[model samples]
Target: MDKFVTRAKKRVGGQSKKDECQRENLQKKPRSEVLKEEFQEDEEVNQFPQPVPWQKIEAEGLDCDYSLLFSKKEADTFFTQLEEEVVYFTGDQTKVQVYGKTYSVPRKQATYGDEGLMYSFSGVHLSARPWTATLEIIRDAVTKATGHTFNFVLINRYKDGHDHMGEHRDDERELDPSCPIASVSLGAARDFVFRHKDARSGQNRRQIDPVKLELAHGSLLLMNSPTNTYWYHSLPTRKKIKSPRINLTFRRIVKQRQRNAIKPS
Candidate 1:
């Protein structure tokens, strides 16, 4: 028992020293460069990204683990900073073929990620734009707090009360399976809803209770795996709130280039 305890203590101490050294090194360099290097994946790296170790919130009757990640002050500042720094565009997503007709998405969005990380959503192929300094800061903060790594971010801007995201799942072929998706909200508060995927089955077909959350400014929400598989989420329009809202959803995409394989007979 003594030997086991001593070994555990030594391991913990070693890990602490390693973390300290890494912190010192990161302090000496620029965040952008550090992020780029991390993407490059050449040296030792931290697996978890949460900086403050945020608390996980468990609401009754909710399927996935949810947490309140940011306060008003932090969210407000980011809203202002990002509005000026990041670019938002509309009509970029390709038209989807539904019911023999093509339709476009309701909101404007921007995608930023490392090279070769392409994302296809709503029949639109979104190529990654190079990472900007502002995004790096936000990405770094998100990763540190949650101990997760993200290669790409989808930025959605709700311009008005009418602008909203309908119920949908994040189960994309290109997405890393079971990976957690981190969302950071800025600007105005909006309604985020989650519904069970079941479309009517259980004898008599009763309605599934919908889960609603107010995604406030400077807030972070994580949609963990199996959550996406079991539930569909949406950002409902709030006609009363006229101000615009920015949502940054960080995700890890499977690199197609890396997935390509050769036949070995």
Candidate 2:
């Protein structure tokens, strides 16, 4: 019996010593300090502003006629200067390859829009040039007429009937969906088609409601809500046209988060 008691006491004493050793080790460790440092580092890394909703504007009963916007002489002069300075392309400037066939885009630019505004696509970024007096005058008139604040304009010079843009949606993640897009067509009037993303049976697979507006030198087309969300629009290629058309798309860009992070040295 004595031997059994002695063995049990030794076992109990061994366990007590092990527990004391663990308690001493935990007391010596700076656990709270370590956790505090980790939390502070996380807070520092995550300190950045979140993106907010973009503003929206709508215009109703606005004049859609081309002749009401500019004179023939002014339109001619603007087109002449644009042709001289704007960069023209024959195929897709981005040159994205897909499905064993490369889709080419023929996009050109003569960017002299607003100050501090920037344009980007794929990975290409374009900074805005200071607005010229002519551009400013045009901008003000268009904004007043449409009731929208357009910050940048992308001028697409379609050289002839052969130059065209293919079927595509303009829903890039960079753009704020709430901000409306305004497109003004000058020169030749072309067909603009809008296709429904979901089509019903017995219906034409694509809706071809054509806007036959002569797009006479200064016509403005504002594309707002529901129209942009449910429809995909494009100006298809036409063979009968002889004159070139200049289409200006006014876009509102959302400020990117990464762009706001750079520290000015």
Candidate 3:
């Protein structure tokens, strides 16, 4: 009995020594390092900033979904990378026509997509540039989150509050009405306003109020169908904002040959 007790005590001592050695090794690491290791382990168990939920923004003739697609840390990383890598149109190519007159777009813009894709708006035609590594990564994430595929993207860079988008409908002939446009915003937060098509015509047979949404950094706004069919949206100028904002509107553009069969908007 004594021998068995002695063996048990030895086993206990050995385990205690092993535990003490492990504590000493941990102590050898800097406190910050130790804490970071602990936090990392916890992070593996429980991811930080759990997936953000999508919010519905519905109104008369409006259907949209809004959500912060990425955490602030993720968004900051993307914004910095995009600012360095995105190439914008320059010179006369940047000019757009409105009301029979041409004016330089207030913001820098670029388009990237599959081969042979073209987007025309405000009398400006933009042929798609090949997708960049950063843009592909963004597109994959957006597709995974939204469950929608896009063949084209229009990247508009607002170089401060002065750069704004005029009120317009995205019901262009090349767009596929069956697909929703995923608009991803990075950097400065800005208000996106929407007005009903009939209201804009000064014929208010039905009292429809305008819809407004604040597009935040790393945010995603899905403009679903029928919403674009009845409403127009714009990012008006906010002169007080000095920081830059980048918006990527992902779309599935029907090839030119298929456009003839598309329904009119």
Candidates sorted on TM-score, descending: 3, 1, 2
lDDT of 1 by residue, 1-265 (tens): 0110011012333457767797799889764455445543522233332344354533333344445555565456557656766666545363454566677767778889999777775555677888886687678767767777999999988888798888888888778875789888888889898877674356665477777888777777887766787677899878898889999999998786323321222
lDDT of 2 by residue, 1-265 (tens): 0010011012333457777786587568554333223333454322322221223322221112232354565456556645654554333444544555665556455455656666655444556666544454456556655557877777777777888876555665555567667776778878876554543235555443333333567556666665555556677888898888988777776667225432243
RMSD of 2: 26.9
Per model, state how many residue pairs clash: 14, 4, 0
Question: How would the candidate models be sorted by lDDT, starting from the highest?
Answer: 3, 1, 2
1 or 3: which has the higher TM-score?
3
The C-alpha local distance difference test score for the whole of candidate 2 amounts to 0.55
Residue-level error in angstroms, candidate 3, position 210: 0.9
lDDT of 2 at 257: 29
Regions more than 4 Å wrong, model 2: 1-68, 87-101, 110-112, 122-129, 200-214, 257-265
lDDT of 2 at 215: 54
**Clash pairs detected, candidate 3:** none
Using lDDT as the measure, name the better of candidate 1 and candidate 2: 1
**What tens-digit string does per-residue lDDT give for candidate 3 at 1-265?**
0010011012333457777797799879654344334433543322333344889999887999999887777677678768877889998779987889989888999999999888887767788999876677678667867778999999999989999999988988889889999999999999999998888765455667999999999899999988998999999999999999999999999896334534454
What are the lDDT scores of the predictions, listed in order?
A: 0.69, 0.55, 0.81
